[model samples]
Each structure stands twice: as C-alpha cells, then as structure tokens.
Target: MSKIVILGAGHAGGSAAGFLKQYGFEGEIVLAGAEQIPPYQRPPLSKAWLKGETNENALQLRSSEFYAENNIDLRLGIAATAIDRTAKMVAFDDGTVEPYDYLVIATGSRARKLPLPGGDDDLLLELRTIPDAERLKQALGGGKRLAVIGGGYVGLEAAASARALGAEAVVIERMDRVLQRVASSTLSEFFTRRHTREGVIIRTGAEVVAVSGHSVTFADGEVLEAHAVLVGIGATANDELALQCGLECAEGIVVDLDARTSDTAIFAIGDVTRRPLPHYDVMHRLESVPNALEQAKRVACAITGRPAPQDEVPWFWSDQYDCKLQIAGLPFGASAQVVRGDSDTGSFAVFHLKDDRIVCVEAVNAAHSFMFGKQAIAKSSRVDAATLADESIPIKETLL
Candidate 1:
C-alpha cells in the first residue's frame, strides 16, 4: 500500500488529509504535528476564544474520534526535523522516520518579533498558537494595560479583545497609519478612529528604538509603559524545511498554479507557499482560511485524477468589537475607489476599480455589497462607478 505523509497538522495539512480520504484515496495517511493537541482553529485565538466567549472544544477543526475513525495515524508532540527528498523519507525530532510515496508540506508561518535593543524580555508575548493565546488571555484579566507593538489585524484584534476585558490598550505603529500594509487609507483612518473612540490610544509614524520590561521607548524619546506588551508585527513563512530540501524558496516556498513545489514529488500549500494567482498575474502568499481550503481541494483533486477546482475571488474577514470587515479580491493598482453607504453610520463598502473594472471590495457591515462584489470579481464584470456610488440602487444591478 502506498503511504502519504503530511507535515504540519494545521488547517492546511489537516484539511488536506481529510480531503484525501474524502476523495477515495485508500493509501495510508500520516498527520504529523509539533503540538500535542489536535488541529484547531487559529483565528479564534485572538477573537472569541480570547474574550472567553468560546471554549477549547469550539476551536477544534476535527475531534480525536474523527481521526481514529478515518484511519489517519496521528503523530503529535513531534516535528519533522529533516526531509530527505532523495530517499523519500522524513526524519522527526523524536528519533523516528517515515517513508512516503508523496509528501505535502503545510508548515505554516511563525509570528514575527520586534528586533529592538531590549526585546529579549519574557514580558513580551505573541498570539499565534494555543499556548500563546492562553498566556495572553491570562495577562488580559484584571484591567491590565496592554502595549501593542504593531497596528495590523492581529494587533488591532488583540487590542479590541483587551478593551472588551476592561484593559487599556495603546497601539504603537511605526507606519503613518494602522493597517498600512493591507488596507486603504480610508479604511485605516476609519479603524484608527473606531479604536481611538473605544479608548485605545494609537500612535502612528512612531519608531520603536528599544523595549525594556513593559516600557517601550520610541526614536523621538517617547515612552509607553504597560503591564504586558503584545507584538503583532507580522509573520515569517516557515520555509526552512523546504529550503533545506533544495526546493525553490522566495519569501515562501514557490509553488506553481497547481501547488506543486520545485520537486515533482513534493507539494506545498497554505501560508507557507508563495503561489501564483493567475487571474491577477502575480504571486501571492495569502494567509486566509478560504485560500487554504481552495488549495487543499486542488491538491486532492490532482492526486485523485480529477480536474482542478475552479478559481475563486479570494476573500477574507475580520471581527473587531461589533464591526465586521470583509474584503474581496486583490486591491492592487486600483485607479479609483468609490464609497457606498456611510462610514459615520458604521456601514460602508469601498469599491476599488482599475480602468472601470472592479478589482477589490472592502465592506464594513455591508454583506450584500460583499456578496455581489465577490461574484463581479470572479466573473470579471464591469461596473458603472456612478451606480456603484449610489446606495439607493442594489449592488447586484451595478454589474455589467
């Protein structure tokens, strides 16, 4: 019997394993992970779970019973230390090896840390894994003060959760505005104002020179003190395993449209892969659950002798306080943008257009616009800016 080994039992790896069985693959499947816990949802680590609204059982992607019933060998509490590509073997940290007819690398990214002068203190915390979230959750109790190092989604979400727990949050961003890397200035300004109104202090265009204890000093000699500091700068792809195995890597493991790595026997997906977005004519390392699920489906179909899954208009969402922000499509190179609804009313959608063609949509509390915008982008439908700007007209009618 053929054996398939999947490294990293996170969303991508775990989903791929289930998909393989769903697609009628009778071969042996091994799901290996470093964490002893079964695969669980990571997004909730910063939102509902952190706020104590959900329990550990609610975060699990699959229960232990499901894995055993499916005949998947669950190798937990150990990591793939090395990949001997030529030998078709994977060596683990616990002095064991597994041979495979095929390999799938789903090792996700790691939380990036601040490279400050005094950043080595144990007081600094990151919110990535279950353990990280548990520690941060403990620190969030009793109206503690939180000093966030970055103003991105992770940072902002944590700040929101901190505020919900009666803790004071102060977000220090090195850029001119929050969400600078991913969102538009209009959206950034809206979030900045919203966070500020919620009693979270936001410092923009400020550089951090050092971090001493819970005190953070800026380049201009400004100081911010708190009980605990959370670093949400970003994440670095865990591509060392791919690189060491002589696979092509740049920013992440470079995979083709089919999610195949440089070596034919290997495939990569999820946050660890720099995959080609054919529609956008660019490569993107998308870190959304939808993207991971889509790639997982594609790989499963390929291995099962089925046609590739149809491409989708990539989308993502974030929950901060009561606001629901949903983004559809890539917003790069947009020549113009149109705003519908009213930001003052906390319901609006920003439509990004390139040569009068809709490329992206950022919807805040506007589900109809997001649903319609996703369809428009997938179909490459044209839209009239005048009609899109008019909220009186239905979003479905805007598509040409």
Candidate 2:
C-alpha cells in the first residue's frame, strides 16, 4: 500500500489527510503534529477561546475517533526533525523514522517574540497557542489593564477580549492606523472608533521603545503601567525542517504555481508556503484559514489525478465586540478608496480602485456586500463605486 506522510496537524494538514480519503485514495496516511492534542481550529485561539467562551473540545478540528474510523495514523506532539528526500523518510525528534511515497509540509509559524528591555517573560505573553490564552485569561481575573503591542488582528482581538473581561485595554500601534497592513484605512478608522467607545485607548503611530516589568515606554517618552502585556505583534514562519531538507527557501519555503517545491515530490501549503497566485502572478504568503484549506484541497486533487478547482479570491475576517469586518482580494497599489455608506452608523464597504479597476473591497459589519464582492472579484468582473454605494443596484449583479 502506498503511504503518505503529512507534517503539521493544523487546518491544512488535517484537511489534506481527510481529502486523501474523500478522493478514494486507498493508501495508508500518517499525520505528524507538534501539538500535544488532536488537530484544533486556530481562528478561535485569539477571540472566543481567549474570552473563556470556548474550551479545548470546541477547538478540536476532529474528534478522537475520527482518525481510527478512517484508518489514519495520527502522531501528536511529535516534531519532525528532518525530511530525507533521498530515502523518502521523515526523521522525528524521538529518533523514529517514517518512510513515505508522498510528503506534505504544513508547519505553520511561531509567534514572533518582542524584545523588551527587562527579563520579564512573566508579564509579557503572546496569544498564539491555547496555553498562552489560558495563562492570559487567568491573569485577567476581572478588572485590570492590558497593553497590546501591535494593532494588527491579533493585537486588536486581544484588546477587545481584554475589554470584554472588564479590563482597561490600551492598544499601541507603530503604524498610523490599526490593521493598516491588511484592512483599508477607512475600515481601520471604523474599528478604531468602535474600540474607543468600548473604553479601550487606541494609540496610533506610537512605537514601543522599551518594556520593563509591567511598564511600557513609548517613543515619545510616554509610559504606562499595566498588570499584564499581550504581544499580538506578528508571526515568523517555521522553516527549519524545510531548510534542513535543502528546499528553496525565501521568506517561506518557495513553491511554484501548483504548490510544488524545488523538489516536485514534496509540497508546502498554508502560511509556510511562499507560492505564487495565478490571478495576480505574484508570490504571497497569506495567513488565513480559507487559504490553508484551499491550498490543501488543491494539492490533494493534484496528487489523486483530479482536476484542481479554480483559484478563488483570497479573503479574511475578524470579529471584535459586535463589529464583523470582511475583506476580499488583494489591493496592491490601490489609488483610491471610496466609502459606500455612513461611517458612523456601523455599516459600510471601502471600495478599492486602481486606474478604474475594482481590485478589492473592505466591508465593515456588511456581510452581504462582502460576499457579493468576493464573488465579483473571483469572476474578474468590473464594479463601479457609484453603483456599489447605491443599494438599489445590488452587488449580486456585479457577478453577472
């Protein structure tokens, strides 16, 4: 029987293993993961789970019995030490070697650590893993103050949760706006106002100069005292195993259009894979659950001699308090950003245009418009801001 081994049991790894069977591949499958528990969903790690509204069982992607029933082998908590392409084997940290005909590397990323001036790992924590959230939750214990280092998704979500827990949350972002890297400035402004109303101090263009114990010093000589600090700053790709195998590495392990690495026999997906998008013809490493699942399905289809699905426009969303923001497509060099509705009323979409082409759409508390915009962009259709602003035109027609 042909054997397939997959590394990292996150969304991509779990989906890849499940799809192999869905496609009627009569082969032995092994899933190796570094986490001690079964495969779990990551999207909630920062939001629901942090709010104490979720548990480990809710985070699991699959039940424990799912593996045994499907005849799939799951090796949890076993870190893949190296991949030996010559022998088609994977070396584990425990000195065990597993041979396979096909391999998939989905090792995601580690939370980028912030360099503080003091030796205070106790006060500073990152919200990447479950344990991290648990520790932060225990620290919250009702009323307190939390200083979030980055104003990105992770940071803002942390700030929102801190506020939900009845804590005074202050978010300090180096950029002039929150979520500036992913969402448009208009969307950022909407969220900034929302956070401000919730009693969370939103500071923009403020860089953290140093951190000593529970005190954070800003570049402008401003300092604040906090009970605990959550570093939601950024992430760094885990490429040690790939580098050991001599695979082409850039910011991540470089993969071609079909998710093939320098070695065609191997494949990389999710945040760790630096692959090129067909629509834009540019390399991108997106960190979203949708992208991970899509890449996994595509790689599985290719391996099983099935036709790959058409690539859809990439998108992501975040839930902070009651605000639901959704974004579609990548807006590179977007020359103009137009708002479709009243910004203060809590419903709007930021239309992005470049030389008259609708490159992307940022919707705040507007799921209908966001979904329609995603479909429009996926079909490569042209949409005008004037019609988009007018609810009478209807966004669904843009796809037609």
Candidate 3:
C-alpha cells in the first residue's frame, strides 16, 4: 500500500489525514506536527482560553481513542526538517525518514517575529500555542500591566483579556486604526470604541522601537510601561522546508484552485498557500479555523480521487470581552456599509457592497444576520443596502 504523509498536525494537516481515511484512502496516513498538543481549536486560544472560560478538556479536537480506532500514525512534537521531493520522503529531526507516494505540505505559519531590539527574554510571550496561552493567562492575573504590540485580532483579543484579568493593557498599533487593514473604518471604529470602553488603552499609528525592562519605547519617543508584553502582529509562512525543496513560493507556497502545488503529487493548504485567487479575490493565506479545515477536506478529496470542494467566501469570527464578532465574507474595496442599528448596542450588521452588489456582511451580536448574509454571499445574492438595513424584510429573500 502506498503511504500518504502529512506535515504539520494542526487543523489542516490532521483534518486532511482523518478525512483521507474517512473517504476510503486505503493506504498509510501519517500526521506530523511540531506542537505536542493534538489539533484543537485555535481561535478560542486567544478568546475563551485567555479569559479562564475554557479548560484543557474543552480544547481537545478529537479523543485519543478515535486515533487508535482509526489507526492513524499520529506523530506530535516532531518538526519536519525538509521535503526530499526527489527521494519521495519526508525527513524529520528524529532521524526518521518516511517515504510517501503523496505528500501534503500543510506546514502552517508561525508568529511573525517582532523586529524590536533589546530585552529578549523568556518572559515575553506570543499566543500561538497552548503553552503560550497558559503563560499569557498566568501573566494576566490582577495587577499585571500588559503592553500589547500590534492591533490585529490577536493583539486586540490579548488587550481585551488583559483588561478582563485586571491588568492595565495598552495596544500599540502601526496602523492608523485598529483592524484598519482588515476591516472597514466603520467596523474599526466600533471595535476601537469597545476596547476603549473596556478600559484598554489603544495607540493608533504607533510603532514599537525597542523593549527594555517592562517598557516599550516607540518611534515617536513615547514609552509604554507594562509588566508583561504580548505581541500579536501576524504570522509568516513556514516555508523554509518548502523553499529549500525548490517548490514554487511567493509570499506563501503558490497553489492552484485545487490547492495543488507546482508538483501535482504535492499540495498545500491553509496559511501557507498563495491561493490562485483572481483580482478582487482575497483567498491568500487566510488565518482562520474554517479556511484550514475546508481546504484540508478538499485536499483529502483530491488525494482520494474525488472531486474538490467548491471555494466559497472565507469567513472569520472573534470573541472579545462580552461581544461576538462574526464576518460573513471577504469585502475588498467595498464602497458602502449600511448599518441598521447603532454600533454602541453591539446589535448591528454592516453590509459591504461591490459594484452595488452585497459582497460581504459583518455582524456583532447578530447571529441570524450572519447566517442569512452568509447564504446570500454564497449565492452572490444582490440586496440593496437600504433593504438590508431595513431589518424588516427577511434577509433570505434578498438572495433571489
């Protein structure tokens, strides 16, 4: 029987392994990941896990018994060193060489390193792992001051959690607005307001120059003082192994619509792939649980001689303090945001339009709008902002 080797046991790697078996890929399937912990939900790590709202029991993605029953050769805590495309095998640090008929390059990304000079200590943390979250959680106890550098989702979430933990949290962002690059200014304003009302300090257009003993000095000569510092800027693709193998790589490993790489026998998914997305398309390296799992399932189907799954609008959600922010689709260069309710109430849906068509919808504390908007976006549903903002007409009817 031919062997199928999957690198990186996170959501994409592990999910593909299980689905390959579930879909009747009758061969050896081995899953490898750098982290020792099994594939668990990651979005919650920054949200629920940081707030003391989740336990270790709630983080398990699958029971150990399930792996045993499925006979998956699960290898954790071992990192893949390189891919020997010519040899058709994967080399690990442990001197183990696994030959494979099919190789899946799901080696996800790592937190983009902060280039600030000075004060590199073991105490400083990045919230990408269970161990990292534990350390952050412990540091979040009362009276701790956290200076979070970066105003993206992770940074904002960390700030919110730090505030909830009775700490003085300050967010330093290079962008002019929180989540400015990712969402509209309207949504950014709403989130910024939420963070401010929760007693979290935010500094937009601020850049960290250095870190020195509970203090982060900014380029503007402003110094931020804190007990602990958490950085959540973004992540860089873990493509050294792939790049060394001479695989086609851009900002990420380049993959086609089928998520297959330049080499048909090899494929990539998740945050590593430079998706073959067209103009006005935003499929490039989406860092969400849904994107990882969905692409993995598609790769599984491809490997199993089945049809690939259709690519839909990628969505993401975040839980901060007491509010849940759900995004329905990617809205690039969208012109209008029709709001039905007030941003203060946290009960509104922001409709994004492209060429006068509803391209995406963002909801806060509105689940029905999210569900309805998702279906509409999937169907390329055209609904005027006025009608979408009315809240009187059923959103589903807009799909027609």
Candidate 4:
C-alpha cells in the first residue's frame, strides 16, 4: 500500500490525514507531530481557553481512538529534523526514519519575539501552544497585570481574556493603531473604543526598547510594570524543512491552488504555505482556521484524485468580551468603504469595495451582513454602495 507521511500534525496536517481516509484513499497515513498531545485547537488558547471557559477535552480536534480506529499511525512528541527528498525519507528527532510515497508539510508558524537587550527571554510569554496558554493562565487573575507587547488579534484577544479573569491588561503597539496591519482604521478605532470602555489601556505608536523582568521600557522613556508580559508581534512561517530540501520558497513554502509545492511529490498547507487567493491575482499566506481547513480539503482531493473543492472566500472571526468580529476576504485595492448600521450600537458592517464590487467585509456582531458579504465576494457580485450603506434596505437587495 502507498504510504502518506504528514509532518507537523496540527489542524491542517491532522485534518488532511482524516480527509484522505474519508475520501477513500486506501493508503497508509502516518501523522507525525512535535507535541505529545493529540491535535488540538489553537485559536481558543488566547480566548475561551485562557479565560477558563473551555478545557483540554474541548480543544482536541479528534479523539485518540479516532486515529487508532481509522488505521492512522499517529506519531507524537517527535520533530522532523531533515527531509531527504532524493530518497523520499524523513529523519525525526527520535532517530527514526520514515519513507513515504507522498509527503505533506504543515509545519505552521511560530510566534515572533523581539530581541531585547535585557536578556529576559524567560520573563516573556507567548500564546502559540497549550503550554504557553497554561503558563499565562497561571500567571493571571487576582488583580495581576498583563503587559501585551503587540496590538494584533492575538494580543487583543489575550487582553480581553485577562480582563475577564479580573486581571488588568495593557496593550503596547508599535504601529499608529491597533490591528493596523490586518484591520481598517474604522474597525481599529471601534476596537480601541471598546477595549478602553472595558478598562483596558491601549498604547499605540509606542516603541519598546527593552524588557527587564516584569518592566517594559518604552523608547519615549515610559515604563510599564506588570506581572507578566506577552509578545504577540506576529508569526514567521515554519518552512525551514522545505528550505533544507531545496523547495521553492519566498516568505513561505510556495504552493499552487492544489497545495502542491515545487516538488511534485511534496505538498504544503496551512500557515506554512504562500498560496494563491481564489479570485485575486496575488498570493498570500493566510493564518486562519478557515484557511487551514480549506487547504486540508484541497490536499486530500489532490492526493485522492478527487475533484478539487470549490474555491472559498477567505474569512476569519474573533470573540472579545461579548463582541464577535467576522471578517471576509482581503481588502486589497479597495477604493471605497461603506458602513452599514451604527458603530455606537455595537453592531455594524464595513464593506470594502473595489471597482464597485464587494471585496471585503468587517462585521461586528452582524451575522447577516457577514454572511451576505461573504457570498457576494465569492460570487464577485457588484453592489449598490448607497443601498448597502442604508440600514433600511435589506442586505440581499443591495447586490447588483
């Protein structure tokens, strides 16, 4: 029987293994992971998991028996050290070698840490793994303070969670506004207002020069002391194994729509791949659960000789303090934005239009707008901006 080896058994890799079986591949599936535990959800680590609203049992993607019953050889607590593309073998940290008819890379990304002068690396925490979340949770509550070094989604989510646990939270951002890289200015302002209303201090345009123990020093000579510090600047793709094997890579492992890397026998997915957008001409590395699940289906179809799944409009969601933010598609080259509903009411949708067509939608507690906007973007339907912006008009009627 042909054997398929999947490395980095996270969401993408784990799901791919299950999908191959679901698609009737009739092949040997070997899923290897660096973590000792079964594949679990990472998104909740900064939200529900951190706030003690969820447990480990809820985080697992699949039960242990599912892999055993499915005949998948799930190897955990081992890291792939090198890949021998010529021999079609992979060497693991445990001194084991695995040969495969096909290989899937889903190494994912790692949290980016700032190199400070104080050499206090141990004092800083990150929320990429279960252990990291556990550590941070243990350090929170009882009026403890958390100093977040970045104002991205992860940072903001953790701040909200910290506040939920009765801990003070302060977010320090280097950019001019929070979520500057990913969100529009209006959304950023909305979140800033909400977080502030909830007693979270947000420091934008602040540069951190050093971190000493529990003290974070700013370039402008401001010092903030906290019980714990979290570094959530961004993530770097874990494409080192692909690079060592001489695969084509730019910012991440370069792959086509089918998730096939430069090497025909090797495929990459999830945060490790720089994949092409469905309708857009550009390629992007999207780090979202939706992207991982979509690419997992793509890899399974590619390996099993099945028809490729329909291209989907990329979407993501975040839950912070009773507000649910749903974003769909990229706002690339958008010339105008239309706001539906009212921001002050804690419910609204920002539609980004490119050439009079809906390109992206950022919806806050507006499920109807998000769903409609997502479908419109997928269909590439043009919209009447005035109709879309008018709260009196039904969302479905706004489409041209």
Question: Could you report the Cα RMSD, in angstroms, for every candidate shown?
Answer: 1.2, 1.9, 2.0, 1.0
lDDT for each residue of candidate 1 in 1-400, tens digit (9 for 90 to 100): 7788999898998999889889988888999999888888888989987899887788888887988888899898999989999899999999999999889999999988678787777778998888888888888865689899999999999999999999999999999999999998889989998999999999998899999658899888978888889989989999999999899999999998778899888889899999988668889899989988888887888777788888877899999988999999988779999999999889999999997788999999999999888888888889999999998898778777
What is the RMSD of candidate 4? 1.0
Which portions of model 3 miss their true places by more than 4 Å? Answer: 119-121, 277-283, 396-400
**lDDT (Cα atoms) of all candidates against the true structure:** 0.89, 0.83, 0.81, 0.93
Per-model TM-score, in order, reads: 0.98, 0.95, 0.94, 0.98
Candidate 3 lDDT:
0.81
Number of the candidate with higher lDDT, 1 or 4: 4
- Local accuracy of candidate 3 as per-residue lDDT tens digits, 20-44: 8888877878888888888777778
Pick by TM-score: which candidate is best?
4
In the range 250-275, model 2's lDDT, one tens digit per residue, is 98989876677898889888889888
lDDT of 2 at 303: 86
Summed over model 4, clashes come to 0
Off by over 4 Å in 2: 119-123, 396-400
Per-residue error for 68 in candidate 1, Å, reads 1.4
Error of 4 at 289 (Å): 0.6
